[model samples]
Target: MGFMDRLFAREERASVEDPRVPISSPNIIAFLGLDALSASGETVTIDSALGVPAIWAAVNFLPGTLAGLPLHLYKRTSAGRERVTGGLATILHDAVNPGMSSFDWRMYMFGQVFTEGRGVSFIERNAGGKPLNIWPLDPCGVTVKRFEGRKLYEYKDGSSRKVTYEASEVIDIPFMLKRDMLGHRSPILTNKDVIGLAQAVTKYGSKFFQNGGVPPFAIEGPFQSAGALQRSAEDLAAAVQKAAKENRLALSLPAGHTIKQLGADPEKSQLVELQRFIIEQIARIYSLPPTFLQDLTHGTFSNTEQQDLHFVKHTMRRWIQQFEQEVNLKLFGRVNNRQYVEMNVDGLLRGDFKARMEGYAKGIQNAILKPNEARRRENLPDDPEGDKLLIQGATAPLGSQPARGIGDNGGPPLNDNEGNDDAA
Candidate 1:
């Protein structure tokens, strides 16, 4: 009956009607088409996420490095695996098709993988089932589904006609698969909050500098009326702008006023530290080390070297394996495939001449690699004599005794000198 009692009764009825907690959950927001916003009030999509330098660096570095590596197709043989040439090998190593180079095609595929979380390529084959060319497909326009106990790809090629591809016809690589295995999770979308925060910090820094390195502040003054206070504030703001434009360090204010900073400066707010932390977070998302992203704030000579090894071993190896397996399965076949593709990660050591030479020397000396093989790795023309495996001959069994000359081995003795002496 009373106003307060009526309000309380209505609230109880509303709560009972809508018992669901978190009225504005992320899923709900997404359903309502409003979930692109992050807690830092920034929009995080693939394009916006790439605007962050660290993210851009990561996306480019991964695909670029992978694309530049030596890719070869090998066939199983009686003695060992031998490099295959001419058909798919030439396509994979030299060019994906007559138009695009292998590096460009691979880079395009992996760029899609990094940004959209999936990469798809259609394998065009001749009548005899020999692959003629590999064509890159836009992951954004492709939809994947499990149909009739098999995976199928429905690609929209900017036309009303949707082309359907069998799982065997496409080389599909996903950053991470969902529960259904048909869907994938994007690194940017899954970790948008962290990227959003990075964007916010970057925007803040830009704005701070844009206003002539001035932080937000308030003026505390003795005022007689609201209008006077307003006028004084406007005049003070104009003066500040003018001083900034003239590159003047000192600011003049009225007698009764003092400027109070509204927020902590960048250093006090730990902006640099936050930025470094953000780089680490992004690195974790990509399984890359901060050093790979050129974050050398904490890098030392020894640790940087270790980071390089970590990148090749931990980060790059997994991606290489995934890509190799995918291409091999689609291009060759899943079962009893004699031919396969491989990326020679040894190219990463090309820059470190000493390390590379030492590794090659060890491989050659241990008979694991022929001298010509090592020379080939260095892109040098091979010599005919360097084709054989070479190893050091100094090593022997611990108990073995040295073999002396004929006098010690029960062979012919040097009897002339001793016999002549006895006769004399």
Candidate 2:
């Protein structure tokens, strides 16, 4: 049987039971589309937040880059650490289960983390406690609570009944935990106002352009009634649209009415600048550089490279460490487990040929990495002579070599006293 089938195989086959009472209500606001109403009068949920291009770019970039990096499992040994193969390693590095590749699973999990604020997974193990497979769980369907000092995960598994998993059985990672530790704070909910403003600005720009670059205006004339005034306004709007469509430079209005702009135009209100500022704000939310979001207004070659370093060190490293620790704790015990999973963040440099080659050269020359190992990184076939550590011959210990004369076959010159005594 598959992991899920075996997990629920023991439950009764009768009618589905009622869901167990959780410690508190599940955090389903993101999925339910009820996060919060922003100051711009827009409802900010996961969907609305993502509708903003900057937010979408940030979310997609973070999760995509992170998931695409290499993930491997390694075992600690007497000589050193070596990568583990087969079994759990295969599940982690290659595929989580038969139905899911490791990259897709990680992308899904991190996507939820960025949008819904939490990502969860369940570990399926054989009889000997050796992990067999890993299965992802929807955060919206899972509720966490502490009972009798132990944390429990109650998941709604598509039945009327809720399946319970101990903390040890679940792998949980939250963007940021609430004070209760049971609930997580979503990025969408936390920064709804900023994202809402972005949406409002985008919508306003679209509407403004849709009206043929004509801002809303006030029609001034001596009208007999409100009906007359409304009709005049509509007529004026239609004339403006017709003129725009016809590529006419002049808009023909009624004899006595004049069009007076009601509000500031996009240029006057600095719409472009506002949109750029919004992108910067979203970047801050994700701890990303604006350059990564395709904002190059202020990007320079030097600073852009610095931003890349910042992303790896300040942003991506934190998530990588968090995921590593969570998987380590879940897959192995806290105590004496020698096996653990690691994400190779250095994989990001794969696209930079110069950087990759330089790093490999340094590693091989310093004997920090075997030549075969460096070649393996580039997917090159290993040579028999490349398996050993290599270093420069000039790097030998200072006192290890004897002093040599300039022209004595690398030995001290013949002693003059001995040669002269024999001659005397």
Candidate 3:
């Protein structure tokens, strides 16, 4: 007999009235998604929420308490049970299974056993006319089968059938309640502890360095790249000095103060000096050679002074373009053919400057050797033959020995003045 029947039997033995007798379990209660197949080959689906309150009422109350209870009492008292069953049905509906109808039997039986005090021992019976007793004596020991597929339910009388449940459905009815449900609480780390953890990470990272090298900032200036030291005051001064020498700017005075003192007058006394300083600064900053600057602005200036000023302005454009183009190449990683053409133009100007300088040096040599009015007018030198003779003497090869000294004489003395002179 089921637990409800046993309670009813006990109530009868006590001779008390049955309060729930007038109202059948089906009329006062309903089960969501509940289905059953009877021996008559008829299937019933219980769709109402209150259709099966008897299962819960029977479990929660004593037998005589509900035996004569009114239908209204079942309706009002069944709210909590209805809520739980509705939630269970919703879980079943969302579960991974063919349909809730397939698992309706298991859900219904489980809900009944859960609400009613009947354990799995009474629910699961073996074929040998004995109870399976799957429910443990200790509440914590009870095992729950998470129904994933069709599980077979068998009776002690050897009746068996396949019962399927939705795999996604979960019934979390605990056998017992306790203070610590699972285990002790875990400890949490504080902010100070986290900082210590970060420090540990940095310490370990330090050990991984194979060379045991000092930090980069600890190295001296000369050890670093030229680019790294470019912004230093010493480097800037050196660059200015080198640029001044290459451009032939007179460095007898400091270039910086000279440019500032010259102001804007192109015809002023110090203007030419200022222009030279500016030109040198431009060439150094842009890394362009000075010859390239001079040839681009020919000799259009009215005087040597104006020529220096003109050269500074003319060269500034070329140097700026070249420096800007190089910067662009680094920034964008490319330069077009047009930019190369511009650079070639500057290079041609530089070549022309070199040729002019060579011709000027030759003229100076001619003037030095023959300083006479008539030779200057003819662009000729008075001692041209002397110069030719000097060139010929420089190219001539020495004989094996020199003419002998006045008396002693083999073929010649090897130590004659012609060979022995230190200058020779």
Candidate 4:
């Protein structure tokens, strides 16, 4: 073959061998909350919560054991005005420079449990016994405020007029997480446990909100007024439970004592395969493709040509890194050269090339099948007899009904017979 032919041959081989077909996998999610406040009698309070499931999965699952480590939850609060070291009036000059108060220091000394892939849900009772939505605030827009014992004076024009108002106002802050695994049913976070934890956390967090500090110029209202946090917690708990049950059902086998047992037997291999097949069928029915799966075995084997698939390698690496940071999960598998390359190329073909081809096919199909309404209006002739024959030959069966149009009933407005009669 000529050089050009040889090059084309290589390209064709690579296209046929593409490995990244039918991407299928789950995504990571996250949630976070923080509060700070100061109130009467020099009281100050700060609270925070962070969810890092992705991180947990990477460290705990990938390496085969959960790492014994502490995740930090930081908080800060301001002390009240008092006598200053310099020769300055206590009221005029702030005594404390907003350093961490002793109370805040003590609170942080005993670090809080920042568990991975865990959530708490609870019912919040408003003073008036009305339902509230608290979910939105936990993972979205939230604020805190503090009220000091002292009062502030608002002066009107002249005559040393003074209006006493308590010091308090609200401050809003936003936090973003790398991932949120709220609804997943991982062994690490069971459905009942997650629900219980969510409930407990919401109960405790509410207490902090209610009894914490009040901000200047702000009147203390019901703590659970913003029902978003509580609602989210409940929803998350429910979802976790549902997912756990489903996951258990999916992994269960008729004769096996455990999921691992089912997976271990060679005889039950077909059953397991059938399960995956059903999952794929469901995905197809929903018009969703499988998530990407990486067989890490390929890279470990001694193969030069396999390693040359730089694009696939880079993509997998990036995915792994994201999984680590967001889910705390690490993937460990030896890359099989043949399977890796095949899957990678297949993924590329199915994703990029297949999409492009489908688009082109759709354009052609529309051009051929769609009646040229504008041409018909202008009284233009249809294609030549030979072209008509070719077009007819190219047309596929009208297996389904066409979409509705202006003043058209829910049926094909015109068929071949009708068109023929009109032409005649």
Candidate 5:
């Protein structure tokens, strides 16, 4: 083959045999001593697949948000926030050790659990038998006992030693698909082809940038000595390499050489559409609007706000509810008047300043929130009149009907207004 032909061949080979592809493929041989997820054999593992832009955006967004939001313990009525002194609240707010705060701990654990389909943690108790510390167990390390009921956890200790745990000994929060007690079923395992295709597209886009997003160019030359020709080729190659590295949009070539571009234009190949399609597929897995995954080709000012609301209501709600229920179940179990945890998702749904302030004003006008509370929320100094719940003039409180006289319709006295004439 000619020099140009060999060069193109090498490029094709490099793209096809990318190291990012999993080991189970015919293109790659697995390392003998390697330990990797079964999912990794098909596509990238969850760890590597997270590097996919859409996946990273969705995954990091959830954990970070949940960690940052104000999670309070409240009664079933939700009238007043309860002060949960010890037990899970302390551990949730501060975590077990200085190595990780509650935010870091929850984010890490929740991220693992949500992505992998389950998160197992050991709730260690103090001398008083209250939960002193909560430590996460690697999902990969724990195996569920199908037939054996009492001995549920067959956990692989760090050094390969087997340590068995009873059902009560560990907290198993699973994202169940069907009847499986163990949360073994995951998207990585079930939707291998879709995820693999996504990874391929992601890798292609990355390589597109890494390879400088430059279309292939060729040089056609006039006759010169073999030595001169070789020297010219080397110089051209070096110049191209430099251009690629620096991301220079313009290029200059040598004299007596005609330049011809190779490959279809990005639009012709539908590169954007392909990436967006993959991103939408990923969003489906997470129950998010494609906009939440940053695919906003069709986004508008009106639709963008709606999309943000949809994300909070549809996407964020699902994950938040899951965490709330799991925390309540694992922490308090079945108990009367159990204080449950709830994330303040109202802030997320509330719109911009004008919309939010108007909503708050309406709340104050309707006596739902005292003006002082609204002022406090807005960081404004409290006014004496703001302490009162001021209702709109046209509206009246429910059951605040005109009082009836004694023995009137066999009821109590309706003498609330003595001077005014009493009318039915």
Candidate 6:
């Protein structure tokens, strides 16, 4: 639920931290050291376009959504209940540094998938072979190779020493992929053209603004001397800069010289629209709504909410499922087993308050929720008989048979109804 608050918030952003990748060349190939980069080539690594505001919003929104949700490790009990309070909770929620919370760890891992298309973590085990700490591995620094049918993961250790791990020891979460067993595809590389366009637009805007929104001016000259014309031009330029900065209305120009304003204004040339179009393109590249990137031009009250939900269901849900499945596989060592990890995704799917209350009322009416249970969920006080599960003129303990309005209070057989009714 706390995560839901973070997700719907408009100002929240995530900044992923990673070491600088080696410059790409013939010898050094991919960003994450995978052949998949050869499939489409990673022009925009995590370092490239990440500085752009649109990319920042898109990348951070994902990991922030993931980190906000609650992750629970549960042991399946025989009575069809999951026990969440276990030793595994420490590793799931508190295994990061002493100051860093569980959200920090989860955000880091989730952010990796966006940048590298794979999130790799090392499971450090104790003497008893139980998980001790889950350490994140830099995808760029990591290289995956196969040896005689076995997979070997190579990454620098904490001490910067080269180390190798078996496939079992590493938790590898691959993004969209085809047949490259040791490779993973990334959005930045696969959609480089779109991202590159966005980056170019950003650079163009920056250069446009850096020169005070004016292009280089041309000086008309047919002077008596070349050096004199140059000196006059330099003097005019200095006078113009000083006047502009000092807020002077007029500049004192030399007599035989005239001024003509140079290039067209950015507004006239639709530069703002161009930048906005690039923002929309970047949003599309990340499969995020333009509104998510602060582009509310096309947003409406009705469609905005639906688009946000679509962002969660279509975009965020993909990464969330990836995180969950990989976590389950690495933590439990089995996909279909009694012990596993589950993410609380209901928070994101929940509707507004009126709708939620109406749904809760329906649940209580159908005996799916007792009055006390609903009250507890809504943080309300429990009533005297709130625990009673009421049905059609009858009441019973949850998961138990209705008493048929019998006087099962261990008193005399009086004041009881034959039909489903409450009695005194």
Best TM-score goes to which candidate?
A: 2
TM-score of predicted structure 5: 0.68
- Top-lDDT candidate index: 2
**What C-alpha lDDT values do all the predictions have?**
0.81, 0.82, 0.30, 0.26, 0.66, 0.70
lDDT per residue as tens, model 5, 1-424 = 8775653342211113443332222122222222232332434466666767887897887778777776766655466555666656666776655466778767877676557766677767777666777777777666665332333666665674777675665776565543434434555434556676767666666766665775566668884788877787677767767888887767676677876777766778898788888788888877777887777888888998888888887877887887777777766676736577777776676578998899998998888999888777667999877778788775568888666666668875545554356553
| Candidate 2 TM-score versus the reference | 0.85
lDDT of candidate 4 at residue 258, scale 0 to 100 = 21
Write out the backbone clash pairs for model 5: 403-414, 404-413, 404-414, 405-413, 405-414, 406-413
lDDT by residue for model 6 (256-369), tens: 666666777767778778778878887887788998888999899999999988988898778778777877776667656688777777778777899889988888888888
Worst 10 contiguous positions by lDDT, candidate 2: 11-20
Show model 4 residue runs off by greater than 4 Å. Answer: 1-51, 55-352, 368-424
lDDT string, candidate 2, 190-240, tens digits: 898999999899899888877889898888888999999889878878888
Better of 4 and 5 by lDDT: 5
Global CA lDDT computed for model 3:
0.30
Candidate 3's C-alpha runs over 4 A off are 1-315, 318-342, 345-414, 417-424
What TM-scores do the predictions have?
0.84, 0.85, 0.13, 0.15, 0.68, 0.76
lDDT of 1 by residue, 1-424 (tens): 8775653342210112332311211222333445678889998878888999999999999999999999998989998899988877899999998899999998998898888788889989889998899999877667675554567777766666678799999999898887756677777877889999999999999988766788988889898999998998888777777878889888888798999988889989899999999999999999998998999998999999888888998989999999998888787676855888899987685658897889888998999999988888878999989989889987999968454455675766455554355565
State model 5's lDDT.
0.66
Query: Pairs clashing in candidate 6?
Result: none
How many pairs in model 3 have backbone atoms within 3 A of each other, for residues 3 or more apart or on separate chains, i.e. clashes? Answer: 13
Worst 10 residues of 4 by lDDT: 21-30
lDDT by residue (1-424, candidate 4, tens digit) is 8775643342200112222110010111111111111111111111111222222222223222111111111112253222223221111122211343322221221111112221111112247532221111121111111123222212122333433222221101111121221122222221223323333434444443342211112222233555844564455344445655455323222231221111123233353344344334322321222231122332354343343344345533343333223211101124311111100123232344465456545644555422333233235665433122112344456866454543475555454554345575
Task: Name model 6 segments beyond 4 Å from true.
Answer: 1-45, 96-100, 158-160, 249-252, 260-264, 371-389, 392-424
Clashes of each: 0, 0, 13, 73, 6, 0
In candidate 6, what residue range of length 10 has the lowest lDDT sum?
18-27
Q: What is the lDDT of residue 424 in candidate 4?
A: 59
RMSD of each: 10.2, 6.9, 47.9, 34.1, 13.0, 11.6
